[model samples]
Target: REVELRLEQANHARQEAAAALGAVMERRRMLEDRLRVVRGELQSTVVRPVDPAHVMRLQVIEDQSVQALKVVRTHLGTLRDRQRALRREAGDAGARLATARTRLEELRNAAEIARQEISAVAVEIAELRVRGESVAEGLRRDADASVEEALEVPRPDVDEDLESLLASHEAELRRLGPVNPLAAQEYRDLQERYDFLAAQLDDLSSSRAELRKVIAALDERIVEEFTAAFQEVARYFEEYFGVLFPGGKGRLRLVDGSDPLTSGVEVEAMPLGKKVSRLSLLSGGERSLAALAFLFSVFRARPGPFYVLDEVEAALDDANLRRFLRLVDRFRERAQLLIVTHQQQTMEVADILYGVTLERGGSSQVLSRRIRERSQPA
Candidate 1:
């Protein structure tokens, strides 16, 4: 819902930019015509050679015309720039609108699916309640015979015992308020539902046992998989760390050596000639490089289709930025990297660069450049 609201706002801003761009274009056209008219007037005035006495007057008029044309041209240039900016703003807003719409549709479909499932369960509940009431009504009408009379043996002694027990509690029964006309039916329906629930609970208990067995198996598999992956990632981490920081010695360790599955992981790096044992003790640039190495290590262990980063190298200096990009380049061989950053070194190394800028009126515009095309940044 919030996303929808934001989409509405973005659309509104886009429309406003469109309108503003049209106005600016119209104003620029008018200014251009005015400049042409001013030029024509100056031309007509100086078409013939002026006499000595009137030359000063003609010159004065020409100077004023030239100044007016300069002012008009300046205004036209400003309007044209404004129009370009507004157009870009509208384009960016449209992109946001499209993305928001897609996300909204996905959310709506998910909610609808859940509603359908709940509605189906509710329908089943209603059907079961009705069938239970029907059975209860039939029993109430044939009070002399039990539903189990055919299956169960006759027992007058047990019946007499139950009658005696009922007689003993008859005073308490009489102390109760008036009975409901549909109490028996309601009770029967509740009992039916309870029985259904009990059966469901038994099924659930069976499922739970199966799930526990599955979980135990999964735990064993996870330990095997995690241990293998951790070893690979740690190997990569150390190798990349050394390359990133020439003489650095970095190691990844599980807090509990015996239980890698549930243990916490620690990364310690001794950079170059430093005696630091923990990552936190390293300088900002050192830490950034260390983190980048660790990230690349995980990617090497289990690569994905693409990796996304936001200002990941913000703390790195130029030298470390180069190292970070180098690692990114190596990882890029296996996975596409999408990075959001303002660092020049990061931008320069990008195969395709995407950027967002604020136009004159404080509206955002999105643009992209491809390294393959040798496109220059503006």
Candidate 2:
């Protein structure tokens, strides 16, 4: 009985190995067929093979892009520094301008007071002259004398308090402070400086407005590009979802429609024959398929040279695995796909195979095979 059991186990192992080999052979045949079709298409279009210099040109372009990005970052730093300096200067200029205006006003007030005092003094001197002329005319008329004799008449004595009054006036003049000799010239200088600062402030204001306009334009452009890309991905998601889950509905909507640049995307999926409204409500396999559909949608929207997928169909059953393979096959001609999976169906769609195994007390070993190069079954 033990010998029979051992034989059964050995047979089972052999069968599993044979199945794996058959899967690899099937993958090889599919790749061969695809290669032939691609060649025929290329010949019909008269398209030449890929140029070896293409990679070198791409590398040069990438290097140039890096240099350009560095230059832009440096220029942005310089602009920020200049903006800070201008803000400091604007504050200083404004404070200085206010002080100059206040000084100019004080000078003007002092000038006006001095002019009033001088006018009053002139009026008093004119009155005194008129009184003296009147007294001389009276003496000439009363004495009936000649012009020279009028001067000989005796005049009244001067007021005894005249010296005291003159002393009082001198004291009052001393009470008023001495004026600034350079006040007028200093006022003119302040006015010129204020005009210059005002012009500078206007220029800074205009520059700020231009910067704001540029920022607004950049924001608008970002919104436009993001919305367009989002819409494309959403459309592709819906189409791919239908293929993966027949009769299913899928959609992507922005969390904030008014601001696409900062908004979040919401994914909604419903598998066939299910009324599910939330992703958490779906089974593990259903969620996996939905996620794959969304992922491939993005891939189609922005294709790269190659993609690496690791066990993406681990939760999928045989039917769903076939659907996943179909989706991958659609991209076969456009880009290279490297799939790492344990599923026999998934492995049966590859053009190359890589296997890893561990030896008893040694290290891990990696085995590689070109599936399309195999001539016969193992």
Candidate 3:
């Protein structure tokens, strides 16, 4: 049991660590992507000119590009560090899982052996009980035969001298009031033995009952503890979901009659006061918004170093798109957001923009541009 518990705890920790690592990876990828974009943009603007007088301006651009390259290099180093941390955590989780599996197998083998031994003992006990009952029956039959024989048997007559002696003894007993002390003493002894045996049987029964109750209580406690653990995890998920779907409300509930092993999450959305049945039912724009909300909620509930969102705003209308950008803006202080989009509005809202375009011969080129100012509100 302890091994199983340790394994479960290790797995939970591993999941949380893995989530953190994923965020970090996303951040790193975004940085690399941005770097690529900046490089591409610089290349597009620095096409070789036929005029020599543009040389100074070209040198200035090259210097700026060099500086940008240095910044990307530094970001790369940070990304490498994040990647290393994630790998280390994953390795530790794998090792722990291996150890848990080994121990669980050993326990299973021991339990199987115990079960076999118990089965053998039960069979032996049943056989012994059957033999004991047969012996008891035989003894009872013999005792009945002996009682009948005693009743039918005749007593031998006393001799004349013994009869005279007996007559004298009988006259003496009459004078002593016919007291029989031996019979009374035997009755008292039998009563004492019966009482002792009855007391011992009662004690044995009570002990067995108490042990069963204790085992039952332990089983209930185990269930309660597990339920509480599950609730804690559910609570975290709920809070995250709420954040992801702002202006909307949703919750997580354990489905009735559903096995935990087979259970899955049910997303309930009350967008604009109408309950949504399936995510697919939502429009393309709504789906994009919902997906983003879900992702954000997960991130908020279990925070990571950063997040990556690829082409996340492609389907949003202008208003919804701005809302999405604003959502990203809110998380800047808590987590770095890496966004990939082709929309100009999205690019306008970016702290840094990386563009990817195909060069003349199908080679992929990257460009980076910083948003100098926010576009005027429409």
User: Candidate 2 — what's its lDDT?
Assistant: 0.59
TM-score of every model versus the real structure: 0.42, 0.57, 0.35
Over the stretch 124-160, how does candidate 2's per-residue lDDT look in tens digits? Answer: 5566557766767886788666656755655435432
Candidates by lDDT, descending order? 2, 1, 3
Model 2 residue 123 distance off true place after TM-score fit, in angstroms = 15
Which portions of model 1 miss their true places by more than 4 Å? Answer: 1-215, 360-363, 373-378
Cα RMSD (Å) between model 1 and the true structure?
Answer: 32.9
Instruction: Pull out the clashing pairs in model 1.
Output: none
Look at candidate 2 and tell me the lDDT of residue 192: 63
Q: In candidate 3, residue 247 scores what lDDT?
A: 60
> What's the C-alpha lDDT at position 140 in model 1?
56
lDDT of 3 by residue, 5-81 (tens): 44345345444534543454454445445444533432331222122233123223333434443443454444344
Q: In the order shown, what is each candidate's alpha-carbon RMSD? A: 32.9, 25.1, 28.2
CA deviation > 4 Å runs, candidate 2 = 1-172, 357-366, 373-378
Q: Write the per-residue lDDT of candidate 1 for residues 1-378, one digit (tens) a residue.
A: 343343344345444534544454454445445444533432331112112223223223433434443444454445345444434544454454456546555555655554565565556556655755566556656765455652243433644654554454454445443445463454445345334433433443353344345434544654575567668878999999987988779988888868654456778889878887886687767876777676667666766666677677777778888887778766666767778788988887788888798999999999988875423321
Answer with 1 or 3, whichever has the higher TM-score.
1
